[model samples]
Structures are given as C-alpha cells and as structure tokens.
Target: METFNLFHDATDVGPDGSEPEGYLCRAARLGPKLGASRLGMSVYDLPPGEAICPYHFEWTDEEWLVVVTGRPTLRTPEGEHRLEPGDVACFPAGPDGAHYVRNDDEAPARVAMVSTKNEFGIAEYPDSDKVGVWAGDAHYMLRRSGHLDYWEGER
Candidate 1:
C-alpha cells in the first residue's frame, strides 16, 4: 500500500496554461506516484472567459469535475451547461460526450479535475468534431452526431 499527503508538500503547479490558458495545481500524481499506470487529479484556476482545455471529449477515458469556486459554462456537443460550486459533472467516453469547461465569470473559477488513462481512449472535439486517438497520433471527424466507428472507416 502507498500513501501520499498532497496537502503537505505535493502541490504541483502545472505548466502555465497556454494552449488552454489557465493555472493548474496538481494535488495528486505530483511525483513518482504511479506504478506502471497514469492517473491525475488537479485543481484548475480558470480566469473569466477562459477555458480549461480545447473543446474536446474522451472516447476511452472518463473524466469528472467538481466545481470548488465560481461558475463555469460547460460546452458540450449536446449544448451548454452552467455549473456552480458543488456541481459535479461527468464526461463519459464516446462521441456523445464531447465537452469542455469554460469559466464564464469575471472572477477566477476553480475546479478539481479527475482523469484516468486508459489503454484505449480517444478525445474528440465537437466544434470541429476532431477526434484524437490515444496511444496513437491520429485525428478525424464524424459526419453525423453521436457517430463513432473505430476501425470501420478511413479518413
């Protein structure tokens, strides 16, 4: 068994958020804490009108977000969702789960993001519907909504 005290000294301030533009404080997986696997838990500080990442969703990995402060507008393929503190959101792996978190407030928004690395996971963007396959370097788009057929077509 292994135990870590992130509150004590495992605070990991991630690389300045530029691609997405935000500040991330990694509370877990800050050190050599994994054993042949990958998992991450981070607290992201998203300034007003800023996004945590590109408008994308995972196909094999599921992600969960817990709002700790301020409100955010969740952009998904389905539509937009406003999230407040204590609001818990989840994105399952699939084309229907295309989503991203954006801070809509003028104040800084903070949320805890939990993610797990899967052997077979792909992330897809909805606005462009661009799909990024994990463990591989390839991206594509679907012609129809909620349509994801791996190894069934060629791009």
Candidate 2:
C-alpha cells in the first residue's frame, strides 16, 4: 500500500524554462509515479498569463481536468470560461474536445488533469497546424501540410 500527496510532490519543470512551446508551467506527473497504468494523471501549477498546454484534442483518448486552486481560464471550442476551485471540465475525444488552460489571474493556479491512456493516439493542434502521433512509448509531431504521398519514393 503506497500513498502520496499531490501538494508535497516536487514540481517538474520543463527543459526549456517557463512557457515552453508545446507545454508550459510546472507539473507533477502523478500517474506513473503512483503506478497507474490505464490512466494518466498530472498536477499542474500554472503561473499568471501562461497556458498549461497548447490548444489541442486527442483522437482516441478522453481527458478531464479539475481546478485545485486559484482561478484558471478554460479555453474551448466554444469560448473561454473562468474556472473556480473544485470545478471540473471534461474533454471528449476529437476536435470537439479541444481545450487549453490558462492562468490569467494575478495569482498562480493549480490543476489536476486525468486522462484515458490509450496505446495508440493521435492529437491535433488546431492553432499550430501540427499533429502528434503516439504509439506505445514512441511519439512524433509533424505539420499538417508536411504529408508526403504514400508512393512518392517507393520506386
């Protein structure tokens, strides 16, 4: 029986400093640390005027987020909404579920994100015209317009 606390966990910072291109803010990957296999979970601490991740949606996995503390703005396909502590948001698989969390308030915001872990998944970034393909432990990102013909160089 192993137990842990989200608040006491060390913050995981990105290699590129604050406001990384793809994913910004500091987070704690609690899922794998807690031995979770079917689900992915992370605790994020987002600073003011920064987004946790880019605006994107998964093609095969569903994701949900809980506002743990402070007010964070949720950007969705509809529009942006302010989220309060304990507020929950669900993003279904596909373009309709595209979302991004931004801390627009004066203070930092804490959020917990949980998602269905699929062996294979594709994610699209509508704002960046890029796509991410994930297969097992391997992942790749490519621009939407960078596709090549299947038989382009087969001969």
Candidate 3:
C-alpha cells in the first residue's frame, strides 16, 4: 500500500517563475503521483500578492479547497473572504462555483484543492472573458468574445 500526505507530498504544478504573476503560485499536482484517475488534488503554496488563477468556474467538475496554513483570501460570486488554517470550502459545478484564491497577507500560505476528474472539461474565466477546454491530450484557451457562428466556416 502507498500513502501520501496532503500537507507534505507534492510535485511541481505551477507558477514556474513566468511573467504572468496572476497565476503564480508554488503549486504541486498530487493526483498523478498517487495514481489518481477519476479525482485530482492540487496543493499550492501562495505568497503575498500571488493567485492560483483568475476567477473561474468549471462546467463538469466539483471542487473543494482546504486551507492548510496561514490565511488566504477567497473570492467567489458572493464576495471575498479570508480563510484560516483548517478552513474548507466546496465549489459545485457551474456559475455558482466561480472562485479565485490568493494570499493577501505578508506571509505565505498553503492550500489544497481537490476535484472530480473528467475525460473532457470546460472551464471559463469570467474576469478575462475566456474559456478553457481540455480533452485527453488537446487543450484550448479562447476568448468568448470571438464568437463563431454555427456554420461560419463550413461549406
């Protein structure tokens, strides 16, 4: 039998010292390492002013976030709230689940996000007006403003 600790075990998953600070976070994807197929868990160590992602929602999966250390700010459709260690929140699939997490304090904080996995997934960024789709191996990120007609290019 194999076991992993949510607060300790993790593999690289984010930030990568990129120019876009909006998605910068010391994150690790643990699902793959633990042989997870239908579910996934991502752990993130967020520094001040860093966010996991822009406010978004999933169309096919439900997620839950657990604060492991320090306090992080969570933004949802309702409003922004500070989450302390041991705090947990559930985000159901759809618009009501739209959310964003960031560290607004002087110190760093850790958080774990667990969600259902799907063969294909669709996510939308309301703040950026973009949509993200993933299937097997191909993934696409596009702006919703670029609307296409049903037969725009079809003959």
Candidate 4:
C-alpha cells in the first residue's frame, strides 16, 4: 500500500497551461496512485485567486470536498462562502449541486475533491452556458445555446 500525506507528500502534477490561468493548480492524483477505481480523488494546492473548476453539476455523479489547509471560497447557488480546514461539503448530482471553488485567501489553499466516476456522464456549466459530455472514451464540451430539434438531423 502507498502512503500519501496531504501536508508533506509531493504532488505529481502542476501548472501545465492546459487549464485556463485562474483554474490552474498543483495536484496530487490520489485515486490512481492508491489503486482506487470507480471513485476518484485528488488533492489540490490552489494558488491565491485560482479555482478548481468552473461552476457546474453532473447529471448523475455525486461529489464531495474536504478542505485541508488555507481557507478557500465555495460558490453554490446560495452564493460564495469561505470554508475552513476539516470542512466537508457534498454536492449531489444535478442543478442543485452546481458549485465552484477558489482560493480567495492571500495564501495557498489545499482541498481534496472526491467524486464517483460514471462511465457515461453529462455535466452542465451554467456560468459559461455550456455542457460537457463524457463517455467511456469520448468527451465533448458544447455551448448551451446550440440546440436543435431531436429530429432535425434524422433522415
């Protein structure tokens, strides 16, 4: 078994420029390292003014967050709020679970995001008016306004 410490363990991933500037973070992908399947977990060291991801919700996967270090701000439908160390929050699947997390404090923040992984899933991003589709191997990010009738493309 592999032992990983949130406070002292070295992170395996860092700023890669793959994500937008404000969404970047140095992360330790714990799930794969610890042989976790079905469920996914990652510990992120978030820089001040940075975020974990956009405000969105999954169609069927539930997510949980655990704050380990500096205070980070959480934004849900209710509005933005600061979270403290040891704080845990659950985001059920769907619109009611829509949320976003950011390191609003002057110092860096650390948080763990644990979520159930579904082979097929859909996520909606309300802020950007976009939708993400994820299947076993296929993925897509599309605009919410680009909708068409169900039969529009049928012969």
Candidate 5:
C-alpha cells in the first residue's frame, strides 16, 4: 500500500521541462512513479488562462478529472462548463468524450486526472486533424489524411 498528499507530492515541473504553448505551471505524472500499473494518474497545476491539455479523446481508455482547487473551464462535446473545487467530470471513451481543461479564473487551478491504462490505445485530436497511437510505452502521431491502406505493400 502507498499513500501521499496529492498537493505535496505534485511538482510544478513536468516529466519534461516544457509543455505545449499557452500552458502555465507544471504537470506531474504520479501513477508510474508510484508503482501504479493498472491506472494512469496525473496532477496539473494551471495558471490563469492556461489549459491543461489539448482537446482530445481516447479510443481505448476512459478518463475522469477532479478539480482540486480553483474553478477551471471544462470543454466537452456538450460545450464548455465551469468546474469548481471538488467537482468531478467523467469522459467516456470515443468522440463524445473529447475534452480539455483551462483555468479561466484569477487563481491557479489544480486538477487530478485519472484514467484506465491500456497496453494499446488510440487518441484523436479533432481540432488538429491528427491521431495518436500508443503501444506499450511507444507513441506515434499521424495526420488523419495521411493514413495508408491496410494492405499497402503487402506481398
């Protein structure tokens, strides 16, 4: 068994030093570091006007987000809504689950994201016309229009 404070264990720096532009603060993936293999968990500290991630949805995984502090805007298929502290949102798999979070308040927002961890998964980015394929720890991104035929070059 393992236990730790979410706020205390979280850091402002992500696994890498940087993230997508327009985002402020840092994100930390805690599940892997904590020996959690069946689920994925991450904490994000977002400054005002900063987004936690791009709008996207998974084909093989379901996800949920908990608002730890501050009110953040949740963008979903139904449209955007403000999430207050202690609020929880569920994102089902597939297109209807596509979502993103942004801190539009004056204060910074802290959120905990939890998801099922699958050995293989596919994520689609509607706004970017791109798709992400994940196998084990490897990830590949491709443009939707660049997909090749299934039997291309088959002998």
Candidate 6:
C-alpha cells in the first residue's frame, strides 16, 4: 500500500488549466508498468465560484466525487444540485456522465475525486463543440464533426 499527505502534494494549478485558484492533490499516478493505471485520487479545494473540470465527458474512464468539506454545486445535464458533506456523485463512462463541480458556498469546498489514469479520455466542451483528449502534457482537439468516427474493420 502507498500513503500520501495532501498537504505535501497539493497544488493551486489545474492539470489542464481549468482554474488558476483551485488546488488539487494527485494522490497517485503512473507506475513502472504500462496500460491503464489508477490516478489514485484528488482533493479539489475550490473557493466560492470555482469549479472542477471544464464541463466534459470521458470516452474510456469513469470518475466519482465525494464531498469532503463544504458544499458544492454539481452541474449535470439533468440540471444542478447542491451537494453537501457525505454526498457522493459519480460520472460513469458515457455521454450521460458529463458533469462538473462548482463551489457555491461562502466557504471553501473540498471534494475527493477517483478515476483511472493514462486512458484516452475524449472531453467535449459542449457549448463550444470543442473536443479534446488528455494525452500527456497537452490536450489535442478532435474536431466536432469527428467526435465519434474511428477505424472500424481491422486491417
């Protein structure tokens, strides 16, 4: 088993430049082996009006959030809901799982996020029709029209 202290690894930078004020703690990351690894977990501390994730969906992985401290507004296609401590939200693999967490309370909000790592996750900025894939240090755009097309028959 591995152990980590959030205070020792937290950062005010968002992996893809979502928010400059929120802090994230990456509990785990890639190991020596290849293929899909677990990104252990993340704790996002967002002050009022900040959010996690830029309203996107994953193509190959799932994510879950657990409210650890203050309340946050969970924005989903179904609408928005205020989640308080002990509340848990899950974004299963698929279009319906698209969601983001925004701190709406006056106090700082904290949530724990767990997801699989190193997989190609197709994220779509719905209103912008801008699709991106988290591949290493950068996010590559997949034109809106080509959001789902892919090689079918094996060569």
lDDT leader? 4
Model 3 clashing residue pairs (backbone): none
Candidate 1 residue-wise lDDT at 70: 84
Q: Write the per-residue lDDT of candidate 2 for residues 1-155, one digit (tens) a residue.
A: 55556556667755366445535688788777789889998888887877777999999999999998899999999999999998999999998999999898999888988999978999999999999999978999999889899999897
For model 5, give the 10-residue run with minimal summed lDDT: 12-21
Write down the TM-score of every candidate.
0.66, 0.88, 0.92, 0.95, 0.90, 0.71
- The whole-model lDDT of each prediction reads 0.67, 0.86, 0.89, 0.92, 0.87, 0.69
Q: What is the lDDT of candidate 2?
A: 0.86
Quote the RMSD, in angstroms, for model 1: 5.4
For model 3, the local distance difference test gives 0.89
Q: Please give, for residues 33-136, the per-residue lDDT of candidate 4 as tens digits.
A: 98988998899999999998899998879999999999999999999999999999999999999999999899999999999987799999998999999888
Stretches of candidate 6 above 4 Å error? 5-36, 136-138, 145-155
List residue ranges in candidate 2 displaced over 4 A. 6-10, 13-24
Model 6, residue 148: distance off in Å is 11
Point out where model 4 deviates above 4 Å. Answer: none
Model 6's alpha-carbon lDDT is 0.69
lDDT of 1 by residue, 64-143 (tens): 88888789888777789998988898877776666788887878777777777665666766667556654556444443
Off by over 4 Å in 5: 15-18
Q: Sort the candidates on lDDT, descending order.
A: 4, 3, 5, 2, 6, 1
- In TM-score terms, which candidate is top? 4
lDDT for each residue of candidate 5 in 46-142, tens digit (9 for 90 to 100): 8888897789999999999999889999999999999998999999999999999999899988999999998899999999999999897798999
Clash count in backbone of candidate 1: 0
